[model samples]
Target: MSESAGQPASVALFGTSADPPTLGHRSLLEGLSRRYPLVRTWASDNPFKSHGAPLAMRAALLEAVVEGLESPNLRVDQSLSSPRALDTLERAARQWPEAELVFVVGSDLLPQIQRWYATDEILRRCRLAVVPRLGWPLDSLQIEQLNRRGGRVEVLPLQIPATASSAIRRHPDPQLVPPELWPVLLEQNLYGLRSCLASRPPLR
Candidate 1:
């Protein structure tokens, strides 16, 4: 979105399912927050995947990861809303009326960004900071098309050599998440473990 001539933009958003908050996300938040004034990390719902952990716990995990890093610019919101990016931008606008919103996302999402609800309106609502995922690097031609169509998207260079949350769910690892909060994930039994623990009781 085009910023007003004299207005200042301060708030940026990072929305994620954060099933268990991956190490790559940790890196992205650190790098992005350094550039933006406020980077709000949201634990949003995803219609495609059945979330293993409850919204409250997912948010807690995100907060724990951020807190472990001691990043002052990052904030976590657990509130449930429409899975669409457009809706999140609208909600952010209503809450931070004067704040210029920028949506931070992974590169894998760019190819399908246009398919999102009210894609045009979403572009008009906020700027985009796209992170280059391992397998989903930015396509030059695709970017060109977006720019030509009035979408303001910037490709970020930060890369995290970690796998997706699903992998962590199937095989929990401290390296994939904040070292300090490893125990929490293990003790709580999130993601893939949920199926195993469904008929069992919590660990003592």
Candidate 2:
């Protein structure tokens, strides 16, 4: 969508499944908002993948996570499906012709990005802002390969990396989520961990 009149254009695209967006996901988006004048966060609706919640439900959960924090320049687009990253970037480019596009991803997902569909094209269209995650080696050979192609990638140095969706899902305490976001999580029914968090009990 073209920026109306004098409005500034979006500069980045944050893409994820966002099965049920967690606090860490919100923090990452907030960090990007600080650096980019216009950032559009989006989630996927992949028919092939088994999502924790239905596509509509996932979208609503993300909407709740970002509610009241919306800005004229910051937008959340839920209309798109699981288009190839390159295709999504192209659409974003068409929508905001003057803006540069950056794709935001976590470090854990960065190393395997080469395996993504049309990854090289995606890289050519937008630079990557890789957020670091705990326990994932930042110095792996795969990272070396990415660095070799580093001209298109920038690693974001996040101050705190301890919080993760997996950790939150695995936490024995059902009360681990902060009060402000508890309703959002519970509303989405994402706290169930029977399959992924085998050792942890399901939230009551």
Candidate 3:
């Protein structure tokens, strides 16, 4: 683990599968980088989901995206060993003992966070910074439940482009991805819109 020189007192780690990171992912990181002293984006190797591409391939795709941005604060972690959410958080905490670890995630994942392995311990280590997702209702019941369980979650209302990786993967037009990122997508060999649309069912 490498640390950025002259980093702020508070650093955040954004971890995800990032099979093929979308514009929303980029927006969240870019936003957080401005607020925090240091921000590192990590792509985990998940054993649960069937990935569209291999771990190395996905990491390379993320690297391409980061390279295009030319942001020194942004980084891609390519850890081969797939650890659970808690384990990854613990490692980050140890790596940056001086900086407070803020875990960045989407609101859609909040409902299921309790089911994550050692979730209580995970919360103890880092505060969660949630970005709102389209179609996911962050209601009172959910908020109460999260608070009742000692969750240190902070909700941020960010109006991100309503484009999910799954939606792009299943859509008829590959142009669903922003025109600026078309070259990256093509270089990464992500299924074009027509190919993806023909290959999978419509987004629900």
Candidate 4:
């Protein structure tokens, strides 16, 4: 993902389950914003997994996290959310016609990319950028497999915390997510989070 003269600005397209956006999400967005001219993210549903929360609620939470970041380069665009990566790419193509789009994903999801719908076509349209998770290592074999399938991938040099939404769902830790979302988590009783914050004073 190098820039050349007269080349359009590169934009990162990041979509996540964001069941409740966490500190890890904030770190990823901040890292991406520093590297790309524009970073667009949204809360989405994974076709292969069951969601604990509704899409609208998840999107709202992600939007709130993005707002807290206050990065001029970062944005939460719910319109770009889609279960299929191909559809999301198409939406981004239409929205940022002049910019080069880099479809972002985590290393933990590398194995599943090969199984996505129109995998080759999605790879063809955008540069695939994989951010290495703390526990998930970038596998050369997987990268080779994707390359063989007409995919162009770049492993981003960004280190985010080893936080996961799944862990928060199971344990309901207030420390895992941003403070701005504490009230929502309690009010909505999401992820059994009420008990976790019961001892603390209410958030305004």
Q: Which candidate number has the best lDDT?
A: 4
Among residues 3 or more apart in sequence or in different chains, the pairs in candidate 2 whose N, CA or C atoms overlap within 3 Å are 1-95
Q: What's the CA RMSD of model 1 in angstroms?
A: 5.1
What do the candidate models score in CA lDDT, each in turn? 0.75, 0.65, 0.68, 0.88
Worst 10 residues of 2 by lDDT: 172-181
List model 2 lDDT by residue over 94-159, tens digit each: 776676687887777865688778766777777787788776646466655765664267778675
Could you give the C-alpha RMSD of every candidate to the true structure, in order shown?
5.1, 4.9, 5.2, 2.9
Off by over 4 Å in 3: 1-7, 80-83, 178-184, 193-204
Clashing pairs in 1: none
The model with the greatest TM-score is 4
Query: What lDDT tens digits, residue by residue, belong to model 4 across residues 59-178?
Result: 888888888889987899989989898899899988777678899999998998898899999989999999999889899899999999898999999989999999998888887888
- Clash list (residue pairs), candidate 3: 174-193
Segments in model 4 whose C-alpha atoms lie over 4 Å from true places:
1-8, 200-204
lDDT of 3 by residue, 93-136 (tens): 66676677888778788777788888778777878888888887
- For TM-score, candidate 1 versus 2, the one ahead is 1
Give candidate 4's whole-model lDDT. 0.88
Candidates 2 and 3, the one with greater lDDT: 3
Local error of candidate 1 at residue 5 (angstroms): 15
**Model 4 clashing residue pairs (backbone):** none
- Write the number of the candidate with greater TM-score, choosing between 1 and 3: 1
